[model samples]
Target: MNKSPGFILTQLGLDKDKVEKLVKALDPKTLQIAITDDFGSSFVLSTLSANIASIVETNVVLQHEKDGDLGNGWLETNYAGSRAFVLRSWKPNESDVLEANLTFWRGAPSIKRVVIRHVPEPATQRLLLEKGDVDMARNLSADQIAGLAGNKDTVVESSPKAEVYYDGLNQKHERLRNPKVRQALRWLVDYQGTTESFLEGRFKVHQAFWPSGFAGSSTETPFRLDVAKAKALLAEASYPNGFEVSLDASNFYPSIDVAQSVQATMAQSGIEVNIVPGEQKQVITKYRVRNHPMVFLYRSADYLDPHSNADTFTRNPDNSDKAKSRPLAWRNGREIPQFTEKTDAAARERDPAKRLQMYLELQKIVQENSPFVIVFQVQDQPARRANVKGFVTGPFADQIFYLLVQKRGSRDRGLAQPGSPILAGPDPGIRAVACDAPRASDPRHPRAHFLRAARGRLRDRPGGTDRPRPRDRG
Candidate 1:
């Protein structure tokens, strides 16, 4: 039950030397310090604070309070972009936070500059790639990626069960409170159709609160499309007019295809769903704050631990901004506890069969009373570039938090093999290498030298002389 805090990080390619060097450079007492500027400090510390906020609710005392700040939050950001973000730190006294944010504009070459354009639709993204407009655009249906894969320029990488896509059953609704309604909705999803039509045969419907590999995950496919059974369940529950509910996620991951599909598919089960499509912010407001929507779609985590993301339904049931559930109106009288106590028992509970038993029970309870319906686990994108070298993938590839090494092409600096010494920084002579290639000293970091070359840390693409496509990326 002893797990390393950075197991995921190392597994994602920040292994050993690179991780050690980066941590040494980033840590205060360590020799190599990346930046000391206010903006950089803000960016780094703020991210840390946000992470802290997510994991453990603790006091985050930061250093400065920059009032009226504005900046752009993008895939690869810089000092200029910091101008676009308005930051509110967890604490107004931590200097490290400032250093991390402004790491972009320190006049040093960065590790990489990833371009993220909100394609929002798979077909358009495919079209853009076919036209050479994007280096990478996400949320494509599995089929779209398959079609794109036929082309040399585009590639698709996804997770088997990276995240769960599910329908939510509001705890407040009277009939929904009954386990029958929630369990019935599970039987209504066309998992095969989704795999064929949306995912393009790239995904499978997953049951259990967690996916197959996690500590408490199960490989059982409990729910399948059975409209007849669903109908019978509804009839037993009484009134087949089907409950009126609003489907919150009306937009698509890559396109409106997924949302529209959900809308049409759910209607097949006789549920009267009012399709509502709007800005995600507005929809989130309605779901979390206003409590106006009965069903909100959620795709949550299944990594590090199964209990990691399960608390959202168990705790954040109330839309109240103060982060507390309202008093219960049930026969039990008292309000249900927002958060079940998480302990060593919960995190490292050893018995797989026994733990899975507990997890199954939780799944049943959640389905019966929560506002989440677990759907098929999804695939995610990884760090892929044209001719880029020295990059590795990790379990967290589905989660972007690790280092990706990039080197200019062979002529850029006569690149060495992985684990080889960095002899002279990036220039036209550097050779680019990929993670899939033989061992080469990773150029995107502070490598020990023959002359010890310094890459942009993430700056230049692999072969710089012939720039790939300088097209205005979205």
Candidate 2:
């Protein structure tokens, strides 16, 4: 809705010239559509109309039919109470036919038809939409969102992902391990200006350590940006000069705001900084070593966890007990956190305030020693099809399954049974099951910002991130 109709025709994927040529074949007004996400395809899709056509959720093509251009799509199956859905794309095999996928929130996905696609990039996603393979995609960057300004027929919603973007501290370094240094870094960041300029007012600058709805996250006081205070902290740390560090980058992900701001602010104290942008995997490998030191990163929350977050970076990696069946982030081959070994006794305290206090104390200790610097806790955001309504945003800032989004022709596509499904975009009786899908591996994964000397442990996990990991604040 933020975009207009005339803009739809200019999109390259629509084959604008051909669409105009076939203007007589379709109703100009009925082809309208709307949706949101910060993915790359959104840039081009934003140019489409929303009057008659629209996309509800994100789609990724797994296997394709060479002859028909129809391929099998995927969704979260481990999620219980989720509806069955599929996007027609590549038909790699006959088995793909009659394949169905469930969208519940938790459990292992027992997919019958849909394939799970972990590394979804914009280029391939854009190609799928332009070819009429899917009606919609999710998430686009500020630049990508602006590019869709010309597309009139499609509705584009550039919702920021429910996560915080901040510079994490490296706990391993004795000097930076100091809270003064971490506090100074926080003061140096121009949170509001940078987020607004980069995310176009879609992102939230969290004032609290934990985002809303998490166990330990609280809405207490806020952290303001203050360069003057930052200078004082540097002086207190005896670092008239800033520390020297190599901001290993994945060429695609590492945000310019993070690198440039960090570089400039530290320079004020005489600390020199270097930047090394390369393939994500190699850079991540180089970064985790005790010898390879990185100071901070721009990050947002990946999941809702107050206690287990440090398990990845601080927990002794060799420890056998695991929250996730596989080796987690920050833990790959290294040692696990000391806290993970000790169970939280607060849960048995039975006193609400006492438990809250205990968790707060634990969080404080983690903050004191951990290399991760949490900026703000964010909220979850999930989008759906306009026609396939009955969707609602939640207090929690992450994706949830189980709610039904009824598409206009989904019955034909074998989604709903028809005869008036949920079409209103509000939380409708949908139950949320927490899906603990393992974080799929990507070679370009930005884990290097946290765990080094542990990359080899990840070899058992096979995967790589999309081209640049546009959101790799780490």
lDDT (0 to 1) per candidate: 0.43, 0.39
Lowest lDDT 10-mer window, candidate 1?
A: 414-423
Please give the range of 10 consecutive residues that has the lowest summed lDDT in model 2: 415-424
Q: Which candidate is the best by lDDT?
A: 1
State candidate 2's TM-score: 0.50
TM-score of each: 0.56, 0.50
Deviation in Å, model 2, residue 195 alpha carbon? 0.9
Candidate 1 lDDT tens digits, 111-171: 3232333333457756765664444444455666666655765445554543566665555
The TM-score measured for candidate 1 stands at: 0.56
The reply for model 1, stretches above 4 Å from the true place, is 1-143, 152-155, 160-162, 201-204, 241-243, 252-259, 315-361, 367-371, 382-474
